[model samples]
Target chain A: MTALIAFDWGTSSLRAARLDERGQVLEERSSTDGILQVPAGGFPAVFERITQGWPLHGATCLASGMVGSRQGWREAPYCPCPAGAAELADHVLWLDDVPGGARVGLVPGLSAREAGVPDVMRGEEVQVFGALQRLDTDHGLFVLPGTHSKWVRVAGGRITGFSTFMTGEVYAALRQHTILARTMAEGAQDNTAFLRGVQHALRAGSLLHGAFSARALSLFGELTEAAGGSYLSGLVIGEELRAQRLQNSALQPVLIGSPALTRRYALALSVLGVQARELGAEATWQGLWSLAQTLDTTA
Target chain B: MTALIAFDWGTSSLRAARLDERGQVLEERSSTDGILQVPAGGFPAVFERITQGWPLHGATCLASGMVGSRQGWREAPYCPCPAGAAELADHVLWLDDVPGGARVGLVPGLSAREAGVPDVMRGEEVQVFGALQRLDTDHGLFVLPGTHSKWVRVAGGRITGFSTFMTGEVYAALRQHTILARTMAEGAQDNTAFLRGVQHALRAGSLLHGAFSARALSLFGELTEAAGGSYLSGLVIGEELRAQRLQNSALQPVLIGSPALTRRYALALSVLGVQARELGAEATWQGLWSLAQTLDTTA
Candidate 1:
């Protein structure tokens, strides 16, 4: 029997899963009805529609990601790091009961500070926890790549700190809005060009200067338009890596996210002579499941 | 009598000046007829309209900037650095004689390469030569700040080499197209916040990480929306400065651009204990006039 219903909801998409008592996925569903697309006062209907046919009785329901943001159905205030499953569980913003007898909870996102500058993440914390459970380690480093890539560190089963790099977003803006677009060609990513860009980014100290290389290389006939996009991708991802100064570090970061992004990050990490392990959707499900375990079943 | 007719024709605006025998501006006219705005085969019409009432009879007319680009009326190939007034004069793409028996020439842009990556600039080359003439220096460092900022080095009255940084363009994209836009306010700049951003950029090692601070700082109420734009401006400008490793360099690069931009650059440079002198449109006219001096009067 399904014991918990978990959601990995974000701005542009919604994902739901039914898990057994052991946090194993029994069934799953998803939709394009993300927070941004939800009409005003429409979250309840959308939620019910996506969770239809799933046995909701006696199964605790928990939701994570921007779904808990201010714009979401219910605002789940952020829990400050270093925090782990217990802290998140303690801070869960309990929602109204559903038609079934199941208790509904919204997982609070995590907030981190470095040198007094604040950083926050909602859905990634769940993945980090799941990664810990998967890796069976109390300490680790993690990177979640997307429009906003997160570099996270955890120790003693709690998140200590993390930083966000707008690498993917910056790449899109440069390619679509800036002069760099002229050199880019559309199609599948060329890994060779991507690696070349990564190597160039690693060797260069300034992204502001290094990014121009794509345009310059194209003008000089040194790099083709077809490879420009991948090269640009490599530069941004590589810049993210360069800033971390990870080349000298002994730590092996665990990359958590979609297969394509993880593979790219893994390839980029290889340049520094570092090997990274790739984790996929299983981490998100596992993370939501781990958070679900912290909820009191007796209640 | 006008000894020369000079045009500073770039991507967005056109400015024409009539200079006397001493290279002094006698009369100036400007319009929105930048090269990009000119219609196909419409440059001659726009040019005729803008130069009306000015005697093109014997004056050698010279146009600089994107007017020499491929899209411009006539493409003047870039002159390789170390180029000076003499090199530009020798390579000028002379156009067909205009009505009234007048000669016309397009000043070629300059090109520089570092580590095999090519860098190109059009109108800024004119400003650089003009700066050299005004400063009366055989060798100096110069910065022309705008959509794309150029860092040029000159020796023996020639631009030895230069680099381009898309600081301004990147700033516009991030402020308008990225999530950071949520924190920005539209209005006059706040110098304090801008300097704060510069200081932060100097302290931080990675721009990819540092840029996020704009959002994070706003989320925590440390920076208000009103100051966000200026702070972002500082960050981009600071990143450019950081890349040049100019913090320790004794070179007080001459600032050549609009008053607003040059003032900001000077302020940013002051943080590193470096003092910079500012030049305005005088540099462009002087540079064009200097190049005109090298032209064959008998021809």
Candidate 2:
């Protein structure tokens, strides 16, 4: 039987896991019916479609991410840092009688304010929290790579702070909309060129100037169009690594994401002589499970 | 009446001017028929349409910029620096007995390769040469801001070297294609926010990190959507200026463009404690005039 139905809904996709009382996932399901893909307040139906055959119809639903943003199913205001499971649980936005009679608790993401730079993360906070729990470390930096890559800090089981880098979005935008679009060929990625890009970023000091190298290298025949995408990816990621000061930091970084993305990030970190450990998507599940546990205790 | 037909043909628009023997603009005409908009090798036809009814239809034609690019009317190969009017004239691709009985000379852009970061400029070199000539500076830096902002070093009436920064393109793509799109508003720019963005970039160390601040501050209620675009612009221009090391540079910058762009760029420089002089679109015309002079001597 499903003890909990935990969902990690974002802008582009939806993922849900049915877990037992001990937070062990019994069954998992996912769909591309992201909140944005569905009409406003139509999330319950999309959730139903994804969970059609699941027996845990009435289980408590603990959700995180953009689903709780102002534009999502409900607005779960950000829980300011240093935020832990306890702080997030206190702000969990509860929805009564959501489809299938499941009571929904949308977990609030964490926010950080610094000198003139304010940042917030929606779904990645769950991964960061789960990363902290899985690694069983009181303190360590965690990197969650996605459209908006996050470099996060956790101390005493709380999200101390984090910054968002527009690395992946930049790659996509340049490839699809800019002059680089004409030069980047899509197909099998070239690892050798990617590494060269990483090396170039490490050596080049500024991204404002470094990004043009994508076009320059390709135009000059240094990098074939087929491999330029990978090179650009490496360059942007390398810039991210440098900007975040992740390279050669005292504390090793724990990268949380799918195998492919984390692997690329791990490769980049290794290139910079910084070792990083990769965690699977299960980390996100565990994070939702932790939030479920917090809600259970509070209730 | 019509002694010369000089065209500043760029990616999105084309401007052709008729000048007397003294290089005075007797009449000027423009069209949206840029090189990119024309069909393959259809530049002659577009030129025909723009020059209709002009008595200078049979006059000597000098076209600079993308019109000579690989995808342009014909590939006018780039002349490596330190190239001046004489070297450029020698390398200019000549087309004999074209439509309207006009011989065409396409001005070649300058290319620089340094430390694996290759740079190229197409239409801006004209402005750079003209700015150098107009400002009467033997040795100084010139900044031409656009999709690809060029920082040039000219000495003794020759183009020594230059670097291209993908500043404006990144800003456009990030606003149009990325998550930041949701947070940016168009119309009625906010200069205060733009200056603030410039300040943030000056203080922040990384463009990858700093670009996110436009969205972040808006999300945190520090910036309105309408003002966010200006801030983003300032961030990009600030990043561009910083990457080119204008803050502490001894040589004053020469800003080239239409009035609006140059004004903003000049403001950005003054904010950084650097003074910059503005040049009008006539600089480009003067540039073409100089190239026209070079071709005349050789012809």
Candidate 3:
């Protein structure tokens, strides 16, 4: 029998799960000390504090996210894709200087060249792998949407390639800082405006032309402040579709994220005459778990 | 001798200049209570507080910028192009009830509809008109670089049309809020990086393609953090050129605003194979003054 701990460390929070031999989470704990908040040199101590008294006398710790960044404990070099579980497992960096003598394994991020564009993915690789484990097909597109959204193509349990969009971050900035902020109505409601905006972008046929039209529509009272968010969402997603069209249009997409975000992606994909399937949150969590299983088998 | 007071009420500050019959400034006063800070119903008191004892017992008050916006004391309806000083003077709105009993004349903002794109200019309209007064040419592009940078085309002393670019605000947000902020070195020291960025953007051929290159170049070490600002500056300026290329290309542009901004614009324009002439700040102020002159002559 063996024990292990898996961590998903992001910008805002650090979440760790204690897993048993069967790859089931025994106990889960999270901390506020994410990459952004924790001191650069304090990663080791912070990790120790989180995993304290978790019965880890002889267990390997698998970590991901900003923890593997340049500012993290030690830079785990990126494993460029078409990378699989074995490649990720082989590239895991082991820390020798932990206080409690715990062996630490850091998951390697993926980097790949697509259409002459070099793209990189960190935590999402594990999640993509996790989602692939739950699927029957070997080939499909997987999307992870957040601050920096990613669209990945997976085949045979390996990440073939991916693309990242500054959609969420741009949306946040536009809604809070730019003139578009004034047009945004208070409170979160249904994405009626979002759908409308997507349709508008589709009709406009270009992101640049569609984006400026948001301001024009607002100025002309065609779109209200409450609907500005939807309009912007449409503009960005529409732009993504246009860019993708310039690249290739054969493959369909599967979205992996929170329900709300996945729905938005689905709506955008639907507008472009593409079908998208939602990968449940549990599937993503399981995707990471599957990577942990691979590590266990290797050990 | 007729007396006039020109008030430039923007988002952050208010400036009032008392002028003589020849449009020479007799006195100037300013306040921090600008349109953004003032309450919706507090313009009268704010105006009274700033313009107190300006010897405007019978002087005409010519106001511009956000002060003539919808939230201002009175809405100065937007006048469509080709707008002229007479149109602005005739359409000027007045404060119906004022404690000081001053003859307030709010300058009407200029608006235009061309190629299905509608644009408007308020405070800058006065400045553009003022700049035109000193120019002998009947047609040229007038560049006003600010929070919402306006690239205006004028002919025959009338405002023909203009395009707005959100360059300054984008710079501020990117520097203060985004991941690019962390990578960008503090303070701008060299125009070398900025100018180089402009050249790269001009070469990339499209604004969107050029923008992504900023990130790619930084990652590839072709761009340094210290030069990120320049890269950004180049991207925006490049995008402006791409947008402009779709419009007219023959007319040389007249650069307006501060020395630094004009210099940057001049450099970008040169990179895009366009020759530009530097116009002075006095033009915008003088444009407002000229509008006041027209009001006086016609009244």
Candidate 4:
């Protein structure tokens, strides 16, 4: 029987997993009914539908991501960081009135202000903790690259601070909505083109100027239409990495994302003479499981 | 009688000026018939309609901007820089076969290769030359702020090179299409917010990360909804200025554009302790008239 029903719910998709007492995944399911898709007062029904027939008796439900955002089922206020599994367990907003009395908790997202600018993250925090658990370490730097990439710093087992980069989202917007779209043609992954873009970005110093190169290079017949998209991807990801220089930190950075995203980040990071470790979605599950374990002891 | 019918044509609108023998604007008219709006092979008709009663019997008609693009009435291959009035007059793509037997020349745009990247501009070349003629000096840095802002360099009576930054388009895209839109409200000009954003961007060092601050700052109530758009504008324009550092070049950059846009640019440039001279649509008219004068000399 499942001991915890854990979810990594975000803007576009909802993923649920049934974990045994030992935090081993017994079964898993996902759907397009992410928090954004849930109508007002519709989360309970979608929750029940997704978790139907699963043994809910004595099971604790916990969800992370935009599911806790202002638009989610219920607002779980962001927990100010320097936070870890213990801090997260304490702030978990419980939805006890869930139809079947299923003990459900919405994991509060983490928020931090650095250099007078506030930064926040939801689902990626879980992935960060999960990577820590998987690696059996308390201190590390973790980068979760996606629509909003998070570069987190974990010190003495807590997320001290982090920064968010709108790299992927900007890339998509420019490729689809701007004039650069005319010159770019989506094709297979071109590592050579991608790395070249990364190199150009590192030296270019301004994204406003560097991004125009994608169009300019194409106009000059230097960048082929087939490789334009890849080159653009490299420029964006490269800009992100250029901002995150590892300033003599002894701990190597761990990149947490899907294989495709992580691979690109890893390649970009490699250009700086820094080797990074990559992890996948399993980190989210592990992070949630670790938080769930803490909740068990506290309750 | 009008000596010339000069056009400053672009992507979204067209402006026509009837210039007397001395290149003074005798009458001026405009239309929404930009190159993109014209139907297939509709340039000649649009031209005739816009200049319907204007004397074209002995007037040499000339056009500048996207009207010379491949998708325009005719593709005028971009003239390589160090280009000036003489070079532009030499490369004008003449289309003498128009139905009305009106002699016409499509002003070629300028193209430059810098740091192994190619940069091109269509109508702005005419504006640069016009500003030069108006200022009566050849060596100066010219910045034309618009959808695609061009920063051009002139030396020894010719435009040596230039760079284009998609600052305005990127701002629009982020405001309309991205999550940042939720935090941003299009309010009246907020100079405090604008300068604050410029200060933030100058310090932020990475646009991908700096852009996210628009959302993050709003999330924390540090940036108000009313001030978001202005702050974003400052950030984008700041990033552009950051890339084009003056580098001890003893020339006050000339800004040519609509008053609203040039005003923002002048304000942004002021932060760096530089005063920029401003120009209006008159520059384009003067540029076309200057080129037309050259045609008279060489004819």
lDDT of each: 0.86, 0.83, 0.73, 0.88
Worst 10 residues of 4 chain A by lDDT: A243-252
Docking quality of model 2: it rates as medium
Native contacts retained, all candidates in order = 0.75, 0.83, 0.11, 0.88
Tell me the RMSD of model 4 versus the true structure: 2.3
Q: Chain B alone, TM-score of each model?
A: 0.96, 0.95, 0.91, 0.97
Better of 1 and 2 by DockQ: 1
Off by over 4 Å in 4: A246-251, A296-299, B246-251, B296-299
Let me know the TM-score candidate 1 reaches against the reference structure: 0.95
lDDT of 2 by residue, A148-212 (tens): 88889888888888988888888888889988888888867778888888887876666767778
DockQ result, candidate 1? 0.73
Give candidate 1's chain B TM-score: 0.96
- lDDT by residue (B1-299, candidate 4, tens digit) is 68888998999999999988788888989999988899998988998899888776646899999999888999999899888788989999999777567888999999998767778899998998888899999788899998789999899989999988889889888888889989987699999999988877877778788898999888778999999999999999988887787534456899999999899988988888888889996899989988888887887
The candidate that wins on TM-score is 1
> What is the DockQ score of candidate 3, to 2 decimals?
0.17
- Residue pairs in clash, model 2: none
User: What is the i-RMS of every prediction?
Assistant: 1.2, 1.4, 4.0, 1.1
lDDT of 3: 0.73
- In the order shown, the candidates' DockQ scores are 0.73, 0.67, 0.17, 0.74
**What is the DockQ ranking, best to worst?**
4, 1, 2, 3
lDDT of 3 by residue, A1-299 (tens): 43678888877889888877777778888989888888867887888899888766557778888788776777788898888888898898988887677788878788776444455667898887777777766678888877777778877767887777666766676668777677777646447777767665555443434555567667767777776777788776665655566233556677888898888888788777787788865553565667767777887
- Say which prediction, candidate 1 or candidate 2, comes out ahead on TM-score: 1
Task: Please give the TM-score that candidate 3 achieves against the real structure.
Answer: 0.79
